[model samples]
Target: MTNYHDPIKHLNFLRQTLSLDKKPIGFFVSAGCPLSVEMPKGEWPLIPDVAGLTQYATQELGSKDEEPYNDYDRLLKEVVKSEKDPKNIEDILSFIRSLKVVAVGNDVRGFNIDALSEIEKNICEKIVEKLDVDLPSENSPYHKLAHWISIDRSVPVEIFTTNYDLLMEQAFEDISIPYFDGFIGSRQSFFDLRAVEDDLMPDHWTRLWKIHGSINWFQKENKDVFRTTRTDEINSSHLIYPSHLKYDQSRKMPYLALIDKLSKFIRKPNSLMIMTGYSFNDEHLNDTILNALKSNPNTMVIAMLFGDLTYKDDNGDVIENYPNAVKLARNRSNLAIWGKDEAIIGTVRGHWHTMDDDFDDSINLANSITFVQKEGEDGEETDEKIYSLNLGDFSKLGEFLQALIGYNQTNFDEN
Candidate 1:
């Protein structure tokens, strides 16, 4: 029970490796996990959770008695079964968008663009509305993350999020932290590919790239992208429409430049990345990380998964029983993964492994003491001083960041 609930060992390992002088470390945030966690009553439903999205999807598809609605429902089920990822909203949006395209010019007879677009708009609206909510005063992980980045005044942190929500931006704003989002000017924020690709971007300025288009983005008559707070109507939004086609669309201007930055950043020596909330659902993004691991031996990724890891079988069916990251870590010595209480740490040898099946070899985060003690020693107190750590809560971003900050602070005091 303690193993599943504790994260101190992993946090300490992270603290030891982190340095302000190392190559820029990036944070990759996704829609699940952090966003899915319920906020306090006053801040309840700050972002759309999985259950809400599921209900929204069901409602959008309508009743099973309706043939068209049933067809859409079947489509969603098929994609889920094929991908073996339950939180795969991108695939669903992509299929609907494709159907709309094929429905043009007698390309398809049954699909309706208006209907599909309606559902897409509904989901996007909810995201935008909730994202714009006021920031809560609680121990927000985003604030802690920003605080961590703020500590290294010499270099700014790079944050890349797949979510369209403004949660990160809001956190930064609330804390008065400055960030560049590839948009130039103030009155009207427009896409600036030049600024994003600029080699002269100051190291002290944090960089945020939303690889997936945000809900505020809309293309005008001149084809120029504009940001707006108007969520009343968004059927014609310029957002890439939350689809797998994002990979293809990503080849275009703004997205292409942003993704290229990620690729180049990770390829640098000593580069480290903390990837959270992502479910490895985006193949393109996963490919980038895998390439980095292969090309940059010094690069490391601490991928934290909130749910069970999954991998594909020989028949290409997703197998949920195995820890996907653990298997991947075994093959790549530069990667470490933490999910719930389980973790696979990289080894001195050219392999990845855990302390043991029971995790006795790992440090106990509570008091920095392991359950495994001297074999012959009776239950007696040792004279050695043991550094203890208290993780107020576990398995949440706030707790993780708190532990990390505390560990770093301890080191600072000792030095």
Candidate 2:
């Protein structure tokens, strides 16, 4: 039996869903969103991707014989000795925090309490410095997303992101779009789990939940966490949740509550969650999303991937696959992986096809799906043809959204 994905039908369904949806619609933005920001010369990103950030951190924290920070290299080696991904900053930071929590007054992993704390400090500082970037201008992708949300709709869009950067915040402010992020107050906005649980805010005001915490978040001496805009007011470590990667600390406040919101959002009847820029590397989030799918059949999770979801081996067997998402999609009909070269929908994996032979958007589907002259290994154009749907890229998704709303698409690049 041959199964194929009809791109036109799927796109029409998506457009219809967006047009007449009265229920909840969410956009799960992740780390890859920031990789779209290019420098002035357009050489590299203003903020590096996770892989690039990890490499940068490793180099920045490397041992310098001239300096006294040799302990960072030693600590990193010990923490990541058996880790499959040795350069993962989140895992490294998690291990450091776990060690610090148990290292009380003694040496753990050959490092004393003081040494471990210093290493943790160095890593956190580097992460904050690298992620603290301003959006190039109001015309950028983030602002496009904000404009999409700013448009009047029956249900205000809910944006749930795992990124710590302030790009989203900047965009929202630039457009004067009001949003709530689990905090309440006119002064120092303090985290109010009760408000988040009660869900009293108006639907017009968008909901922006940073499940992994943000760089501007700070904890005071009184154990109260607040959001601050002034760097001088940042007194301590940024309240990030990579520490919750620990089993013992998984139920900590704020992190646990924010994650719960995601589960709640998906459980709503007739809901849609469009995921972009996520690598699906975090097992905890993956488990949460999968569990929510089981609990609610009405909710749909559209996981758009930046690459192929699966590929065939030399023998023509589909041996390679996105293990987590593919395995989950095999059983769940509500879950869909709209990948670059392929897609997994309704428990079937295959390339994209269109029922319409005279496809009007064959140049691409909705300014997102691109029809390419398939290139060979040498990068030369081949006789073969292929289709690539890249709504997974934040920029493309933004463009798609603008076109969907019939907004200012012509002047999108002017700024």
Candidate 3:
């Protein structure tokens, strides 16, 4: 199940995409990878939001400390038992959100709607608190990334991210890099769907689309959306918290429009998408990528996995080193995979291709998929490099961005 690919091959693919004829290039940054920054102590929770609720339910709920949390615990246990892949905090919260309306009719001995609501609220609060990381002050990596985007006049760019944090926004603001987020107004910004729908974006201005909801974004009683700097308004926070209902949430206003833009972007001719920090675990997101590939022959997707990709086997056995991505990349000439140690490039739909024996040829095969011609053996190509981080370290985002900056700098210097 190993999906590891050579970093060199992956970078070569990236260089080609940057050089594509595509007018405006786009990139995706998943929460899996973020600018490396230390989260402030005591400001965030140490355990999963569900875990905290479990403890509260067991302890604060009197003699039957577990009674209050029994329903949630049961749901979590069932999810663990039923899911082939290991579940995360988001998975647990999402399961709870799904039960909001569907859990009607069937009741055990009794059903306490109030108790369930309280638990849900607590979970959401815990997550918001946990994610309220202290923004990086001096020498922020996101600042550098923004600066790169601002200076790279060679191609127009669009940035899409699944992260709910304001780090990127802060960086862009700090550096005065002009960009559009589909929200307008100097006082109370609202979702300008018309601008996005009409494709009024300028090629020089970078467009940032947060596919998922953000922490600062809130809704008023009248349903007007506004951005804020306050983190204490739990009730006002309108974010699409980690929940199974995310797909449904995405169907609504801003998300729907934003997602549609993503779909359209990938289906355009001469398009290339560079995805990082995303694990492709979300079925909806995976579907979007797969559909984009199927719809456009000239479009290509290059995904970089930050860790060892793993998945469950047919028999539900946990398979290590095997990435779930292989299922999509397999036999797909438009999709290429790069991980810590291995590389899989699109080729004739037959045997699995490995670069272990022939690294140079593998690079050539990857380049060929994007119509990138390699110079002679002695010809110098732009310097590209891959960066890695320790397992489970989200702070490595900073390091990854720094590596990206270095990689781009090398290319700029050489070119």
Model 3, 43-76: lDDT tens per residue?
3332223335345433432245646656555555
TM-score of each: 0.73, 0.89, 0.69
Local distance difference test, candidate 2: 0.79
The candidate that wins on lDDT is 2
lDDT (10s digit) by residue, model 1, range 1-415: 1223234445545556554444567888777635544577675556665556655556655465655555556556655655644354556666666666665555333546665656566555555544556546535777767776766545567888877767788778877777888877665577877778774577777898888877677665455666666544333544654544432342256667777888877887777788777666566877777887889887888776664344568999977543445556667878766554245566311211234324432233323222323233676765432221222122255554645554554432211
Q: Which stretches of candidate 1 lie over 4 Å from their true place?
A: 1-10, 36-38, 41-45, 60-87, 112-119, 126-132, 230-235, 238-240, 244-251, 307-323, 347-397, 403-415
How far residue 202's Cα lies from its native spot in candidate 1, in Å, is 2.4
| Best of the two (1, 3) by TM-score | 1
Output the better candidate (2/3) by lDDT. Answer: 2
Each candidate's root-mean-square deviation in Å?
7.1, 5.0, 8.8
lDDT of 1 at 74: 56
Q: For model 2, how does the per-residue alpha-carbon lDDT over 242-303 read when each residue is reduced to its tens digit?
A: 64654233235678888899999999988999998887788889999999999999899998
| lDDT, each prediction | 0.60, 0.79, 0.58
lDDT of 3: 0.58
